[model samples]
Target: MRNPLSDKVISIEPSGIRKFFDIVSEMKDAISLGVGEPDFDTPWHIRDEGIYSLEKGRTFYTSNAGLKELKVEICKYLKRRVGLDYDYNLETLVTVGGSEAIDLALRAMINPGDEVLIPQPSYVSYLPCTVLADGVPVVIELKAENQFKLTRQELLDGITPKTKILILPFPNNPTGAIMTREELKEIVEVVIEKDIFVITDEIYSELSYSGNHVSIAEFPGMKERTILINGFSKAYAMTGWRLGYAVGPKEIIEQMIKIHQFAIMCAPTTSQYAAVEALKNGDEDVAAMREAYDQRRRFLVNAFKEMKLECFEPFGAFYVFPCIREFGMTSDEFATRLLKEEKVAVVPGTAFGSCGEGFLRISYAYSLENLKLALERINRFVERLRAEKCN
Candidate 1:
């Protein structure tokens, strides 16, 4: 018998984030701040739309590119909310989720051995998708001194002759760092000169604090070079519905659509109907969630500060990455100790990148009550560690 496995499949480790989630599942009394998902249920109105679709017997496939009205509404929402103007016909491709959009965009454009520039301490999918797409992932680490924002210098440093794509995941995950318009302008200058393609994952755009979210599409000469990925999941608490969309240059989007068509014919029929409702009627729900999340974000930051654990205040996503070096433990060790001793679940920052070694990421997506309890548990854990140090 042959020991058969694809060489590409052999090189990657299983997802680090999944390991902790699985562990927490078996442990009773675990309070998990590890998962990246929103705690809110899918809003009643949105759920009702899907249920209504089924009763109407509209249970067939949508157009492979997705419903025309949904794509039109996506264009309108982007313009109204985020200042990104996209063409519904020529520039957009509806995907199964932002995950599949990432995969399809990479598959459509990546030639083998081409380098894909990704900022570290980002969502985990980008690296693995780059590898699976037969593209080389060159990670540029985002730094604490920079508030985990990727600098233009860092962007330039990662580029070489073979570099083909740059993924911009602002209003970022894990670190919660967001880039400003001036910062994005600095990056756009280099990217335009190099003629490099960009994949901008703006799924968390609505959840931003301090300012309205800006899009790379707003930059001069960038709409042609940028692929914009946003979805129903993060913004509308619709993760389980599995709907996302991408918009970019027609040539690129058309190629992605080809890949999407062959692999998956259409997004879910009910999800398409529900997503249309979300884009239409769900803005209020999003605003309410963002308001609640901002409070949790404030609470989590103060908890870290009270413990004397150094942390940069996060601006966008519902996570805080706090330095754990004071504990004199590796990120994994700190995480393991927290889970075992206090029954609290937080992700090791190293799960995001090599540079995340001295940190831990805690999600603020839970309710105020659960967050209060988690913080109390964290306080008790930290006090015990201090007493142990004194002894």
Candidate 2:
């Protein structure tokens, strides 16, 4: 038989986060703090809107870009929240999820041999999406000393004549690092000087525990060259709804919409209607959930501190990336041992990138009760590890 698989596809490994999550799912009495999913149900009013949409038979495919009303609402939400303005009709393309927007933006923007600068300890999809788009993935290792925020020097070092797109995964996953407005201004200068576009994934925008989430696109001269990707998943707790959107220059957005048009047709119609409701009337629900996540975030930070674990206080997202190097084990080895010995599951930081070695990403998206129970196990595990080292 002839060979059928693409070498490129075969070369890609599966997600390391899912590897542990699947194992924990099968293990009895195991608790997983690995996945970044929120514990909240989709807000009640949003669910009601979806049900109402179905009852009204609003089941047809929306325009490839999305429903006009939803697009307008997304624009309003962005402007109101982030101080960025975009034309709903000309600059926005609704996608199946923020994941799809990441993929679509890469496919639309990259040509073969183009280089994409990806900051490490970010969401897993960026590097692979660049590869699938036939672009070279240049990894920029973010320093823990800098709280994992990409710096101007680091961005400048990553750029080359071939560098075209920079994937800015701020309010970052796994690391929970966020760039302030001042920090972003430094990056903005480098990007403008280097003439590189950016795909800024801000899916966790509202989950930011620091001040308001700042997008690189919020900087002057950025909106035109930046594809801002966000969705209802992190903030609105609508992960399963499979809804997200991208906003950028009309030229770039038109290209993304073309890919989305043929591949996805449109985002789910009912989810679109529900998201409209979410944008219009779900602020209070989001605020309540944000408050809960903030409490859990603080609890995890304090728990790690009390355990004598070396962890930087992360200011965004519901994860804590604590250093596990003192245990004298690689991140994978430590995570594996913890799961096997204590039935407590967390992701190895290396899953995000090699730069994440010696760290583990523990999500606090679960309830306080679950977090407390898991922390007890984690503390016990750390005590045991320290005793072993002394021996």
Candidate 3:
């Protein structure tokens, strides 16, 4: 048989976070802080809604754009939470997950050789999805000094004639960074000046610890040019439900819906129903979960500080990016040694991008008990490394 894999597909790397997770899975008594998933179960009310839908025989596929009721709920939620108004009929698309919405958005907008500027360290999917869409992925290395927030200068530097899309991954995954409204205005100015489009991934929007999450789509002249992707996974602990939505200009949403119609048909009907309940009646559930994550976030940051590790205080998301450069080892080496010696798993920063070197992303989505135990093991490992260096 001939070599049959597409070169583009062959060239793409698997997610770095998953690699460590697989190793941790087989190890006995291992504690994994590698994955970004929430530890909380789908809230009872949300799960009950899905169960109710199934019991009522609503298992059939919804319209390709999604159930009208679900879309309305999504719009209402966006308006109530993010302060943005969207047309449920013409400007929204339901997707398999936030991941699929991102892929579809790139597919809908990217032409061959179009450049998509992606900020790092971010979620693992953006670069691969951009490549699969036949777009060039240009990475903007965000600095820890800036709290991993993208700067206007970096945005300006990354733009070129071929640049067509800028991915704003805020309330970032591995680094837990968020861009303030003032910071976004500066970026919006650059985007408008350069005449480029943006795909803002705000899946973690509800998890912002500093304040209410702000969407760039709320800025003047941005809603027309920005594709906003969000879902219930992070917020409602519905990761397995695989429901997400994209809201943007009608022109863009129509194209995304076309791709979604043919490729996915529609999101899971039960999930859509569950999501409706989540949007309508799950605010208290979301608030309660956010509070738990906030507590864990503070605990992990303080733990890292007490260990004398240089950790940037992350105000959003459930992960902490702590610098391990003081140990005179690469991030991958440190993570590997810690996992092997202490049975504690964390993802190396390089998993997100090269700029993540010398850092490790420890997810605090686990319980306080798990986090405390993991931190104890991590502190011990660090001290052992120090003692070895002295010896």
Candidate 4:
């Protein structure tokens, strides 16, 4: 038998987060704050619309570009929520999820061996997708002391003539750091000077605690060069629906559509209909969820403070990355021991990147009772680590 695996695909590591999840799932009394998804169900009104659409026999393949209605609604939603505007007719394309939008953007942009600058301790997909597209991933480590935000100098240092794309993973995963307009402006200056094409993953845009999100697209000369990736998953509790979208220049959208048309004919049709309703009437759902998450965010941050773990308060996403270096354990060893010894499931920070070593990513998407229990167990576990070190 011949092995026909693509070396590029086989070389990449599997999602580090899910491996621990499988082991933790079998534990009798485990509390999982490992996965990065909202605990809320998709809102009733939106779910009803999907059921209605199915009952009405709206089950055929939508246009390769997606339903016109959904794109129009996305246009309206982005403008209302993020203060970033895109022309629905020409600039937007619905995707299977933010994942597909990311792949499509990379495939549409990268030539073989072109370098894509990716900030570390961010999402897992960006680096793999770049490799699969035959693009080289140039990793830029966004450090904790810098609030996990990529600095302008780091961006400038990584650019070369071969640099073809930059994936801006902010309101970031695992760390939850976001850039204010002024902060993004510093990077924007370098972007404009080098004319770097950007893919900004704003999936967590609606979850920001301190203030509103500011899109790089809103910055001068950026709209034409930035592809904005957002979706119904995190914001609307619709992860299973698999509905997300990308908005950018029409030329790029058309190119991405060609790749999407061949690889995936369309995003699921019913999800698109539900998404239209979500766009129209889901602000309240987002606000309510954000408020609850803010409470959990505060609770968990305070827990870490009480435990004396070194961590920065997250701004947007439902995750808190706490440094466990004081425990004298690698992230994997600490997370593994915690799961078996105390039965609390949190992802190792190293799952995000090498820079994520010596930390753990704890999501706050569980019930208050569950969160409290996990916090108690985590505190005990940390004390145990300290006690072990003393011996």
Report the C-alpha displacement of residue 365, candidate 1, in angstroms. Answer: 0.6
lDDT for each residue of candidate 1 in 354-374, tens digit (9 for 90 to 100): 888898889999988888998
How do these models rank on lDDT, best leading? 3, 2, 4, 1
lDDT of 2 by residue, 105-144 (tens): 9999999999999999889999888899999999999999
Give the alpha-carbon lDDT of every model: 0.91, 0.93, 0.94, 0.91
User: Model 4: per-residue lDDT, tens digit, 173-231?
Assistant: 98989998888999999988987899999999988998888888898899999999999
* Two-way lDDT contest, 1 vs 4, winner: 4
Better of 2 and 4 by TM-score: 2
> Candidate 1: where is the Cα deviation over 4 Å?
none
RMSD of each: 1.1, 0.7, 0.7, 0.9
Tens-digit lDDT string for candidate 3 (162-228):
9999999999988999999999999999999999999999999999999999999999999999999
Candidate 4 lDDT (Cα, whole model)?
Answer: 0.91
- Minimum summed lDDT over a 10-residue window in model 3 is located at 298-307
In terms of TM-score, how similar is model 1 to the real structure?
Answer: 0.98
TM-score against native, each model: 0.98, 0.99, 0.99, 0.98
Q: Is candidate 1 or candidate 2 better by TM-score?
A: 2
Off by over 4 Å in 4: none
Clashing pairs in 2: none
Query: How many pairs of residues collide in each model?
Result: 0, 0, 0, 0
